[model samples]
Target chain A: TQLLEQSPQFLSIQEGENLTVYCNSSSVFSSLQWYRQEPGEGPVLLVTVVTGGEVKKLKRLTFQFGDARKDSSLHITAAQPGDTGLYLCAGGRTNDYKLSFGAGTTVTVRA
Target chain B: GAGVSQSPRYKVAKRGQDVALRCDPISGHVSLFWYQQALGQGPEFLTYFQNEAQLDKSGLPSDRFFAERPEGSVSTLKIQRTQQEDSAVYLCASSLDLGQGVDEQFFGPGTRLTVL
Candidate 1:
């Protein structure tokens, strides 16, 4: 099984502070997706980085896929209380339709 | 109605009891998936369905966990003789199609099951 290890299992930061969460694995992935889930809710797709060395920006968040496709990262700019939630990274193929998730990073952005 | 929806947002079952959770995927979605999430952990893949066919169930922890998609749109995950270890949030997701590379999956609020 391919395992995704996420760093900073828990994070607490003040509003306006920036934070970066990482997802790493020794196994190569064809595609990697980042998801953010709030309490009592399932995860919502934040971004999907497919190509090696690919970088995608979604408003205040930026996602990067390592050149080897074995790791990825999510950077949040100017965090807010609304950003407090569990952030997860899943690695899998575009067609296989299976996702192996990381342990997750619970971010608490205080006001 | 607009997004993936799950029934019985919460379920409480005594040990050895049987429980069934339901998932209604978004209209027109061709791919559906089930995942189990323990507290403080990320969601783990349980099964995947394409239309009325179950394509993969390799993630099932045991034979006691069974999932099916009869009509392709609605799915059910039935757990027999539930145990405390079965306590977790069951999430359902749907996508346009898995054949399309990198399709975004929309998730439901999920059903939280607690086995006593």
Candidate 2:
């Protein structure tokens, strides 16, 4: 069973539009990470949030960790064609080395 | 520096045949991980290694799936009996440290396995 749930299994928006993807779970985690994956390749880390209620910004992308640490969100401002890919959220526990990943949201930005 | 790499980016196996996938992690990385990703799904953890020790194998699907990292750098995943259901992408990741809360896992391009 998948431990994390992501909304809007797929998202398609035009260039310059804004989009937000959410990851939620009932179980709390010590850390959460966001990754973007392209076809025929592995997922690449975008950001990691360790504290609850923490918001991080990477250029035009914004990431927020829920106060309970059981959920997280990723928002992209002015989406571009280059931003098209699969977005995945993974949760990590205090002592466990394995990560539980959400099914992921496929985002497509059209020009 | 070079990132993690997997050999034979694509593999095709006949049903009931055995196949082996190899992963070479970044140099000096202490943690290695294996994951299986199905179409339209996120990668699922398969196993983990801390140095040369197999720290966790709970995620391994069955005894048919076996992994080893004897020298702590190069690892191999072997499937004893390939089945159609075994088709998926196998990814290898490595981290500089042992903990996941603070370290970033560098992933390889992955090996796509197809069992007919």
Candidate 3:
């Protein structure tokens, strides 16, 4: 089974719309990270939320860590075409460097 | 200068062929990782290096896969007798450290490998 699972395997929205992607897991993580990847490239770090219930904002993207440390969510306000890509979530457990990853959410923002 | 870098942005191999993918980590980084990503799937861990030592290789799919970081900087992942199932995007990442779980891994543009 996948250690981390993301919802809405795919999403398509018009530019300027708002949407949220979820990353859920059964195992607790010491730290969780969200990444965005464009085609033909590796995933890029978007945000890393450590503390439970932690919320971080990267411009229009708001990331939240679940209180149980087993889930996370990323909400994009006023999405732009540039935001169209694959969003993946990874988690690092205590004393582990190898992160477990989720399948990913592919987002498409149409103009 | 700010992130990891990989060579041979794309690779195509035939069955039973041998291939080597290289990864140049961010300077001064202590942790290096290798991951394989299949189409439409997330990156899966393959191996890890801390400086010049390989600390974890349990994630490697099989014995046919091998990796080395002889200089503690540039790393190489070599695959022998590659099969079609071995085709995937190989990514490299570097971080400060993995001891206390404080480092954030910076990734590079992965090399997409297609085995026919």
Candidate 4:
């Protein structure tokens, strides 16, 4: 069984602040995906990093895959009230269709 | 185009009752997945289907949980004798092709099930 742990289970910040969330695991994965979910809605994919040391930026969000593929991070720049949501990191193994997700981090950006 | 869709946005059932959740994947999608999300938790994989074939169900927690994707498009997850622990939001996702590497999955709003 693979486990993904997320740091800073909850976060609150004022508008324009920057925040970083971390996801770590002992097991290596072939791909890692970041998703943001708003209240009462399903998670929406933000970005996916496949290679080691890979970084992908989506507007105000930046996602990084660890060099060992065992960890990942999501950073939000100039956060806004609309950026508030539950952020989840999911790791996908080679040849497997299933994804193992982290516990998730809830972020609240106050305007 | 419409994204993946789930029916009965909310469901409340008595303990020991049987409940079935439905999922309608995007047209022409080849891969479909089901996940369970408990309150305040990330979604956990429950099952996967490649067209009409169930390729993986190892994530299912118990024998009482059953899922089927008949005709390769619409899928159903049925739980028998629902328990309090079964209360959770069930999500459905569909991808355009096989493999989890490149094809991005589109998710549905999910069905919130509450076992009373």
Chain A alone, TM-score for each of the models?
0.96, 0.99, 0.98, 0.97
Per-residue lDDT of A53 in model 2: 100
Model 4 RMSD, rounded to 1 decimal: 1.2
- TM-scores across all candidates? 0.96, 0.98, 0.97, 0.96
The DockQ-based CAPRI class assigned to model 3 is medium
- Chain B TM-score, candidates in order: 0.96, 0.97, 0.95, 0.97
Assess candidate 3 and give its lDDT. Answer: 0.92
The DockQ value obtained for model 2 is 0.75
- Whole-model alpha-carbon lDDT for candidate 2: 0.94
Worst 10 residues of 2 chain A by lDDT: A92-101
lDDT tens per residue, model 3, B1-116:
66788989999999999999999998998899999999999999999998999999998999999999999999999999999999999999998876335468888999999999
Tens-digit per-residue lDDT, A21-75, candidate 2: 9999999999999999999999999999999999999999999999999999999
lDDT of candidate 3 at residue A99, scale 0 to 100: 88
Which runs of model 3 end up more than 4 angstroms from their true locations?
Answer: none
Residue A30 of model 3, lDDT score: 93
What fraction of the true interface contacts does model 4 reproduce?
A: 0.57
Indicate the docking level reached by candidate 2.
medium
Model 1 lDDT tens row, B1-116 = 69899989999999999999999999999999999999888988898899989988998899999999988789999999999999999999999876343778899999999999
| Candidate 3 per-residue C-alpha lDDT over A25-110 given as tens digits, one digit per residue, 9 for 90 to 100 | 98999999999999988888888889999999999999999999999999999999999999999998778787888999999999
**What is the Cα-based TM-score of model 3?**
0.97
Clashing residue pairs in all predictions, respectively, total: 0, 0, 0, 0
